[model samples]
Target: MRSEFERRHPGVRIQIENIPGEGQYVPKLLMMFVAKKAPDVMHLDASYASVFIDNDLLLDLTPEIKSDDSFRLDDYFTNVVDVARRGDKLFAIPLDFTPIVLYYNKRLFDEAKVAYPAKGWNCDDFLAKAKALTIDNHKEPGKKQYGMHFINWMPLWIPWVWTEGGDVLSPDGRHAEGYFDSDKTIRAVEFLASLITKYHVAPTHSEAAAAGVDLFRAGRAAMHIAGHWMIIDYRSDGIDFGVAMLPTNAASPKTVVYESGLAINRSTKKRELAWEYVKFMTSAEVQKVRVSGGLAISAQKEVAQYYASDEQERTFLNAVEFASGPWGARVEPYAVVEDLGREMMEDIVNGTPVPDAVHKTCRLIDLELSQQ
Candidate 1:
């Protein structure tokens, strides 16, 4: 891609600067800003866009987009593009997106004589199948197979709370006090932990560590909660998989839409060059190349429709309307909130009482928010 971009513009090179780790990215980017050495173009992730949007680190692309006759903002998913927008001002062009969903192994379901999971299945239905599938092979006690896979990732599990009418932060993204510790949220957290501890349908953290392989990817788990990105891994492993919406007890199902985009650094001296690069990267032609590998559903609707070859891809598209952008897009200090939430979940999984963990985590989150 970099080579192609350089080929189009003579003597102008695109220097790719990578931060290497998610933990080190923001800090290093900030240091670059202080040193007046930030790149002309940056790959923007909507999951933590607030860290840039709130600081005015990105240029508003609205004018550039409007002036360019060949491009239209509506070409990409509106909800995704709006993640980096502050009112009428736009900052980024979406590259691709994915919504968290339930991924089930068809082979496991068939072998166990269990039915495939459907979109509208509730938590109760999910639990019943999980329990049945977990203990289906009664003849062999030595070989173990799990029904689902659970991880300590807060982003991955946040949808479980949402499906139960719960959330971690208050409206307007200012607080986490009452919201994080609310009864619904507490109940949701407890239910997730019970899958590992009480029902034994999902592997515990230690078990996953001992296994040294992703249970779902290894085909030892029947159902796993994940996003579209897993399609690449599953396809490579030659596993037959299907995607389904997260189950719900609330009025409607809920999940998070994570997106990535390209933005021009506000301080870039070569603004037009950067804008051209952004436009090229987000074009349908480029998206077709990127989407071919099943990494994510394309942000470009046309490209997305063109590449949605099967039911799993179609299911992911059906989820876009109901999916909400991650709170990190709105909340500036969300990385801190994510860490606190992960700690709370880990505590519950390790035997701390759910209420106690919720209360403790919420208080700590409130303290941190107050500092901000």
Candidate 2:
């Protein structure tokens, strides 16, 4: 990737540094910033942008975007653009959007005599099909099958909260709104839990990791809710499954999305060059490489559509329309917000009330934002 990037632009050196996904990135960037030696242009995960932007370490490229003839603002999805915008100002341009979808085992559906999920299917439809796919051990003691396999984690389940008409924050971002304790939120959480306690369509969290995707690979589970990143892995496994849009309540929006992009370092001397590199990265050329290469959902509308030429990719693309940024989706203090989500997920897995969990998370973030 670096070789190709460098080949495209002579005299421009590109260095690829590997780092762990979670906490490692923030401290590393912070140390570099302290030394005033942060990279001119680099790709960062969505979660770490808050710290960098908060410290005034990222360049403001809004004017450049507005004035540059070569940089077309209308080429990408508005949701992606909104994600990179904090306080009505652009900090970065989204390189890709991550949409979570439902992957169903065709063979399992056939065995259970359940129909495939159509694109606009609703939550009731999902529940009915899930129940149909669920197999009780009493009928087949040696071979136990579940209708669904859930992560017991919120990242995997956030869509349902949205589908139930709940959200993480108010439009103004002043207070916790729909997501934590709303009726819709409770309904979503209960529905998710029913897969285990009531319907018996899923395994416990521990059971899932020990088993991994084997259950789906072996036709033991009817469906799995996952991000677009797993398409290649599943394709490699050679499973006879199909991808579909996540089922939503009739009253709710029909989509969910997670996006990440590139921001220029404000502290760098070469701000114009840095912006150029970033501009190029989100442009159609590199976006094609990213999407077609199965790396991510490209921010470019054309590139995203091109990647969706395949059936599986089509399902992923259709869901992008209904996408929402994570709570810390655009803000610079995303790490702190993400940390709150992580803690809330832990509480959910530990049997805490969903409202309480979300409330606690909200309080923590509110405190952090106050401190900041």
Candidate 3:
């Protein structure tokens, strides 16, 4: 990509700084920003865009987008573009995105004599299949198998709340008081918890750790909920797995998405050059290369066609249709809210009553929101 860009514009050099890990990526970028030495263009997670936007650290690209007749923002997914925008102002342009999907082991389903899940399966179907596929160690003495595997990650279960017609915070992103503790949210949380406690279909954190981080790859879990990033690893491990959309609820079918976009630094003197770089990076040619290489779902719908050759890829593309960014991504001080959410999940897994945990989490989130 760098070579291609350089060839297109003689004497123009693009310096790339590769951040090795997610742990220190943002902090280092923040340090650069504070020192007024930030890059002309930087890649940012859609979830973290709010943090930079709140600080007025990113350049607003709305006028540039509107004036560039050759650049059609409408070519990208609406939700993806919307997430990168604060009101009508564009802060960035999404490069790629991923949505959570249900990944199941074909062999496990065959062994259990259960039918494979289809694209539009509902919560009831998921529960019934999970219960059927689970093999208690007591039943066979040596054999160990679980129907599903889930972790404390918000993206894994937060979609359940959305499908149940509940949200983590109010639409205005002001408070979490009523939404987090709503009946629908409580039911969604309980349902996820019951997969471990009541149905015994999922492994606890300790049990999962003992088995390994990739339980589905180890053949210990039949179904796993994850994103497109797992595709390369699963394929490399030779797991006979298939992808399906997340189970639907009575209200709707929904899934949470993670995306990254390229934004210009507000302080950059080379604003036009930065916009050109962003445009080139998110172009169909670049996206097609990235998506076909199994890096991520392309931000451009036309580029998505490059990944439709296989069933699993097609399933992932289908999932993009219903995917929505998490509310936390749009809220200010998002890291604080996300940290509290992780703590709330830990409390729930530790056997705190769902309502109690929800109430406590709501109060904490509200406190943080008030500070913002």
Regions of model 1 farther than 4 Å from truth: 136-142
Q: Write the candidate numbers in order of decreasing lDDT.
A: 1, 3, 2
Model 3: C-alpha RMSD to truth? 1.8
Candidate 2 vs candidate 3, lDDT winner? 3
lDDT of 1 by residue, 1-372 (tens): 878989999898988887897578888887898898989888888778889888889999988988999998889888778877878999889999999999998988888888888768899999988886785347864347898988879889999999888899999888887798999998899899999989999988888888789988988788898888888899989999888998898887888999999989998999999999999999998889987888888899999999877898898988998798898888889989999988887788888999999999999988988997
Estimate, for each residue in 131-165, the C-alpha lDDT of model 2 and write its tens digit.
89988778754356778887755566778878878
Clashes of 3: 0
Model 2 segments beyond 4 Å from truth?
A: 4-9, 138-143, 177-179, 212-214, 250-252, 331-372
Model 3, runs deviating above 4 Å: 139-143
lDDT of 3 by residue, 1-372 (tens): 988988988889999998788668878998999999899999988767777877889999998898899899988988887777777788889999888888999999999999999757788899999999898888763356889987777757778888888888888888888898899888888888889888889887777887755778888889999888888888999999989888887545788888888999999998888888899999998887767767688889888766778899888877777888766458877677778877887787788998999899999989988987
Q: For residue 137, what is the lDDT in candidate 3? A: 86
The collision pairs in model 2 are 50-332, 50-333, 57-266, 59-266, 98-258, 167-179, 255-322, 256-322, 256-323, 257-323
TM-score of each: 0.95, 0.88, 0.95
Global Cα lDDT for candidate 1: 0.88
RMSD of each: 1.7, 2.9, 1.8
